[model samples]
Target: MDETVKTPVRSFDIHDILKCLPHRYPFLLVDRIIEAHGDQSCIGIKNVTMNEPQFMGHFPGHPVMPGVLLIEGMAQTAGAFCIQAQERAPDAPPPLIYFMTIDKAKFRKPVVPGDRVEFHIERTNRRRNMWWFKGRALVDGQCVCEAEFSAMLVDTPTA
Candidate 1:
């Protein structure tokens, strides 16, 4: 017999991120961005689970979500903000923004299975095509990870 259980995924559901970004399974961290405040800030959601591949080696009996993956989730959420910002502008043209630097990074609590990581980020600064952002990952309203990062929005040559 073949069977599968499909859990409801709205806050942690949006799969369009796979198409919008280059990240894939295991690396594809973010589940959805439920709220956005223009180019100012955004809120993304990630649902942690025991089924995640990293759980196997991160710890055999005890599983803990890696801080780096959490940061990636935050940065990716910022990338989405940049993408949405560009989409809002008529003359911005098609492009991709690459993360350049992350500073003042901090990891607080341990994120385990069944925890919903709410990623929040705010635009700190922007100049020309370069953008700077402050990001944080939270669980139950407590900070888990935070970082300050910069990115460049580049225009690709017409194909």
Candidate 2:
């Protein structure tokens, strides 16, 4: 007889993302976390549309999704994964994740409205409450941007 245990895959929709992240409205770049494996990796999706506020002035006629926002979406995906992986008390407040560092960022192509950007993030290292991740942003299965970033998770202070 053989015995094995497998970790179930987790996924988060917009509502679940709202509970895991502090971002809201125009700043909430991630639309859904399609797959998560423990705290090691996850893939998030963002649907770009012309109605977004950034398109107003980012370019008068040619709108491109800012590279910085792509990086932010990556961070948010990893942050949400970390929060979801934590083993906390039922009544505990969600920890706050702060973007600490961004490195090796590169933009390969422009992401425009109607493009569905996918944020692929993988945890490269972790210590205490700090984590490091390498991420790539892809559109139509082509790499649009890539970066390595770190974040720190802080417990929410009680009032």
Candidate 3:
């Protein structure tokens, strides 16, 4: 008889995300993460609002979440997942994750205000402290954007 151990799915709220990532407001894109399975995959939610700073200059009359920001959101979501999945010493500082590459990025539709954008990310590969992910930004269950990206995790420098 063979018994397989399964990793339990985890979820992260804004506070938990704050602990995992270093991003703050005006840049922090993911509002929450759900169905996270030990960095294998996770779905991140971002609520687009008219009050966002980008709307002020992105367009004078119309407000649309920029495609670049969408990609950044995907990267942030993946970064948070990588951090949360790792094991570290209790006193160790959170690792700093840097965006390394964005590839095969395609924008299908413009993300607008009031849209609840969900970033679905799946890990494709991982080497040492680097990880690669395939991500899709969806709105109301429809795909709005997709991309493949990579990030590297580095330890924080001691003061």
Segments of candidate 2 deviating more than 4 angstroms: 1-5
Candidate 2 has what TM-score? Answer: 0.95
- Tens digits of per-residue lDDT for model 1, 36-62: 777788889999999999999988899
Question: Which structure is stronger by lDDT: 2 or 3?
Answer: 2
Ranking by lDDT: 2, 3, 1
The lDDT leader among the candidates is 2
Score every model by TM-score. 0.82, 0.95, 0.96
User: Which order, best to worst by TM-score?
Assistant: 3, 2, 1
| Span of 10 residues, lowest total lDDT, candidate 1 | 5-14
Residue pairs that clash (backbone atoms under 3 angstroms), model 1? none
In model 1, where do residues sit more than 4 Å from their true spots? 1-16, 88-94, 156-159
lDDT of 3 at 145: 100
TM accuracy, model 3: 0.96
- C-alpha RMSD for every candidate: 10.4, 1.5, 1.3
lDDT of 3 by residue, 33-137 (tens): 976989799999999999999999988798889999999999999999889999998778889999999999999999999899999999999999999999999
lDDT of 3: 0.93
**Alpha-carbon deviation at 78 in model 1, angstroms:** 0.6
What is the clash count for each candidate, in the order shown? 0, 0, 0
Q: Which stretches of candidate 3 lie over 4 Å from their true place?
A: 1-4
